[model samples]
Each structure stands twice: as structure tokens, then as C-alpha cells.
Target: MSVSKKKFNLVVLDMAGTTVADGGLVEQAFSAAAWQMGADPESMIGYVRATMGESKISVFRHLFGGDEGLAQTANAAFEAAYGERVAAGLIVPIPGAREAIERLRGEGRSVVLSTGFARVTQDAILAALGWEGLADFTLCPADAGGRGRPYPDMVLAAFLRSGAADGVQEIAVVGDTSYDMLSGARAGAGVVAGVLTGAHDKAQLVEHGASHVLGSVAELDGLLGELERSS
Candidate 1:
């Protein structure tokens, strides 16, 4: 199932739901922040979801209405709770994530991880997955001027860092959100793949410019074949 009509030189992947299951940790952290602030815990999910692909501080600003003091407060609480949660070692790589990354690397394709997570959090996940040195490049939102998803900064940063800038036409952006798809499209990447493993539904992803949507990363292997052939 070769999806690429021409093999891509590089593939940029989103970290949270695409490379690892940090969604729970994120939700938990937000919940704690809401609780500390005496806000509705569930309501915070909607705010945080909107910040899915942005920098931590930017997300905090978005969540707390740009009040620097409140953002600082919420951020501290969120980080504290999230750090404790992660220390319990509950997060894990999504199914087929490791295999897919290994497969892509084995094929000599450069693999870059572009994510909205904080650099510290991203580094922790990379270490936990034993992928710190495996990935060709790992880019955090901070490098992209603290902008979040729907902006191409993080993806572009990874592209530049991976040396894919030379072959930007041969890069794909894969993630579980419309933000990722839109970012990829804006970046002029070869393909924008949306997965259903996160909070977004298929309709939402497609509505936002996903050229292809899969049920999960487990289905990506075959989809890539089709994508390659079609490319």
C-alpha cells in the first residue's frame, strides 16, 4: 500500500496524541488549574482544547484571558499537577507510533516531531519513549514565536531543523487536529493527514483542510501507501 506517488524526504508529526498519549495529562493539568482558580473544571477543557497546538504560556494566556498574573498562576498549577501525573508513568506512545517512526527512519526518511508541548514536557516524553536521540529533530512551540496550532511556525521550524527546507515539497504534516492540517497546508507541505485519535471528529478535521483522515495511527501504515501512490 504505497501511498506516496513519490517518497517523501521528511515527515513532520505532532507530539501529543500523534507520538504520545499526553492528552490525559493535559486534561488533568487543566482541571487542576480550573479547580485552583474556582472555575468550572469541565469548561477548561474547551479552552485548553483550543490551545492544543500553542505554547504553554500562550495556551495559559488563552485559557486565562491574557491576564499575566492569572496565566502565571494557572500555568504553575497546571505544570505541578501534570508533572506529578507524569511521574506516575501513565503516559505511553500511541499504538503503531514507535513502529511507524522506526519504519520511516528505516526507509531513510527524516522524521521530525513538531508539537505545542513545552520543551521540558517534550523532552520528558522523548526520554520516556527512548526517542530523544532517535528523532531527526524535535521542535517545540517556543521555537516558533510561541504561536500554537493553525500557525505553521512549529512545522516550519521542524522543517528547517530537519533540513527539509531544501525539499519542502516532499514533506507531510500528520496530526489529530484541524490545527495540524491547516498548519501543514499553510506550510505548503506535500500532504496533511488528520487522525481521529484526539478530541476532534472526522467532520471537523475534514472541514479544516485535511486531505486525508484516518481512524488512528494504526491505520496510517496502509493510508501512507495510498497517499504515496496518489502523490
Candidate 2:
């Protein structure tokens, strides 16, 4: 379906897998956290891999069988491990990610970088990548009332905070996971695009409600252009 360019004035993007490449750090950190809490990492890895775009605490809450205390401790450890890796310079932007954000903004869109990680870990990544102010704003679960992907809170938060879009239908959401697609769809975004650069595959993305699928976020601006022409 073709959409008007004016329909997507606010762009919400996922951080880790969509814009930033962390080299499987999330799984590694999950393993470390599991081990620290006396759980077998192998036993929980499948679920971890399946829910890539979910908030870490939420993931832990499920893994720990709704034990909030255990979930909190595990989440803290995961953040710490991930933070250390970021401090060691272990993350990099997906090629053209920075350029994509610039191009989107250049076209008068308000770009928001959203993440499933806690604020501290997200901040570490921004600092490491020198992306402190690359987007109009950044969001984590806490910024959106402690809910994340698969619930739509973060995406809705970005829409409300940016005020760049007149309504949910004016928002564009791009990410690399099924959960990201779900969040965007649930939030009633005009365009929920999935990229192949991270976690889930094309089928998974489509199954989760992606309006479009692209090779990478670098193609986002081009996709918008295509949408304009088709419209």
C-alpha cells in the first residue's frame, strides 16, 4: 500500500539491532546474568533469542517465572555486562545508520531512537557511538511507563513526545525484530517496516505485522521515496 510522505513525519527506530550492531552481546550478557543467578543459560537461551526486542527486565521476568526480585537482579547483571562491553568499544553503528538518521531528519522527519535496554545501557551505547544527540530524542521502557515492545508504550511515547506527527497514523516505525513490528502495529503507526540486519527474518517480521520489509535501515529513506511515488 502506498502512503503519503506527509503521513510519516515521526520516525521511531530501534537501537541495538536496527541502528547499532552489538555482536551478540545481548545473548552473552543474558548468559552472564543467568549464571550469576544460578540458572542454566542454555535452558533460557531459546526464549531469549525469540524475544529480542522486548525490554530486558520483561524478558527476565518471564525467564524467572514472574519472580520480580530475581528478574530485577538478573536485569541489573545483564545491563552491567552489556555496559562493560560498550565501555570496551564493542559496538558500532550499522553501516549507513548515521547517514539514514541524518537523511530522515533532513527530510523534516522527527527521528527517535528507541531501545529495549535500560537507560544506563542505552546511554553507554550512545556515548560509545558518539550518538548523544544524533536523533531528536531517545527512549527506553522507563521513559514510557515501564513497558516496551509488543506493548506499544515506547512507540506511543515517541509519538507524544515528538509532536511531529498529527496522530498515530502519521508515525513510521522501523526495527529489526518481530516484537518491534508488533509494537509499531499496536501503536497504529502508518508504516511499520522491518529490516533484515538483525534478529528475525522476513517471514517473522511479516508475521508480526510489518507493513514493509527492507534490506537494512539504510534503505529507509529510499523506501519513503518509493512510497511517495507509488502514492
Candidate 3:
């Protein structure tokens, strides 16, 4: 891995299942929408659970390949259902996540959030978390004009937006899913860390190329500090 002269410059976070508590609502919504759109229930829900960190449209497209209109309809239903769920319930922040983020910011690290949810659902979630403007930037796949997790686009977008032009290795990406780990690794981030707070466990994360596996994002600050000192 390339080492940066500056320990680290940016941290790209995954919103759901990392900074925010997911509690499986997104999977529920996605599964429901897919079933309504004529997908087989058994395979559909499983696929969704596996790719929950991915963009809704991407999952739909993969499931309903060549049926762009059907995929679009399913995506709309997912967003609508997910929006309603958020509006009706009290969404909570993951334990210690807000504090950890604040600590990182105190140390002059640029932090941003990338999510699979579209802008509308992300907006409702931010409002619920009271996390508006909490990060330097919060991005959806659409915001960066790229496919979501497991792809490098969103992480690269965060790197650019956070002013990290020279040292890609000075960037860290943290999330609870293997997709997030893959995204960070594919983007050539120095620290592709995975947390167990959302989806995958330690083995799954490691298999996906996570260099550091924490119990949760709560450990991120300390982990980075250790990396900085070790470097």
C-alpha cells in the first residue's frame, strides 16, 4: 500500500449501517419492492440482503436486467417505502459514531458520508439523525453520478471533494459491508476498514479486502491514531 507523508487527509463514511443505525429497514423495503415487481421472493430478499449497501437502482437493474422501466419502477417503490419507514419511526445514530466523527473532525480530518440511498431518502435520514452538515459532505450515488458501493466512484468523489488530490493513500473508507470495503480498496484508499455494526462480520469483511476490522466505527479514531503513529 502507498503511504502518505501526511498520515491521513480524508475519511469517507458509509451512512447506513455505519454512522447511522439501519436495523434492516432498507432490506425490508428493498425486498418488499422487488417482490411487488414480480421477482421471486426467495432469491430476491437474499440478493437484497447481500447487496444492501449497493444503490437501489443497481440492485434492481441486476435483478431485472434489460428491463430498465421495470427496474426504475422498483427503485421508486423502494425509495417511497423506505421514506415512509423513516418518516414514521425514530431513527437513531449508531453508538459512539457521532462522537468518533467529532473527534476526527477535531483532528482536522475531512469527513464525508456516502450512501446507497438516493437524495430524498438520505434527506429524511439526515433530518432524523439531526446530522445535517455534520460531515463536510454527504453524498448519494446520484450525487457523484456513479454506481454505489463495491465501486470506486463514490470514494473518489469524496477524495476530490475533500481536497485530497495528491495522496490517495491518505484516505480511509469505513463501512459495515463488504461492498464498502471493496469500494475503498478499488479506490486505492490507504485504510480500507470495516466495522461489524451493520452487515458483514469479521470474516466477510476480511475476505472483501478490509485491512482493519473494528467492532464498529466507534473505534475509527483510535485506529487512525495508531496508524498515524505507526507510520
Question: Candidate 1 on 145-173: residue-level lDDT in tens?
Answer: 77767888877777667664356667878
lDDT of 1 at 188: 86
Residue 189, candidate 3: Cα error in Å is 0.3
* Model 2 segments more than 4 A misplaced: 1-5
Cα distance off (Å), candidate 2, residue 75: 0.5
For each candidate, give its TM-score against the true structure.
0.88, 0.97, 0.94
| For every candidate, C-alpha RMSD to the true structure in Å | 3.5, 2.9, 2.9
Point to the candidate with the largest TM-score: 2
Tens digit of per-residue lDDT, candidate 3, span 45-117: 7777788688888988888875899989999999998888898874678999999999988887888988999
Ranked by TM-score from best down, the candidates are 2, 3, 1
Off by over 4 Å in 1: 1-6
**lDDT of the candidates, in the order given:** 0.76, 0.93, 0.86
**Highest lDDT among the candidates is held by which one?**
2
The candidate with the higher lDDT, 1 or 3, is 3
lDDT of 2: 0.93
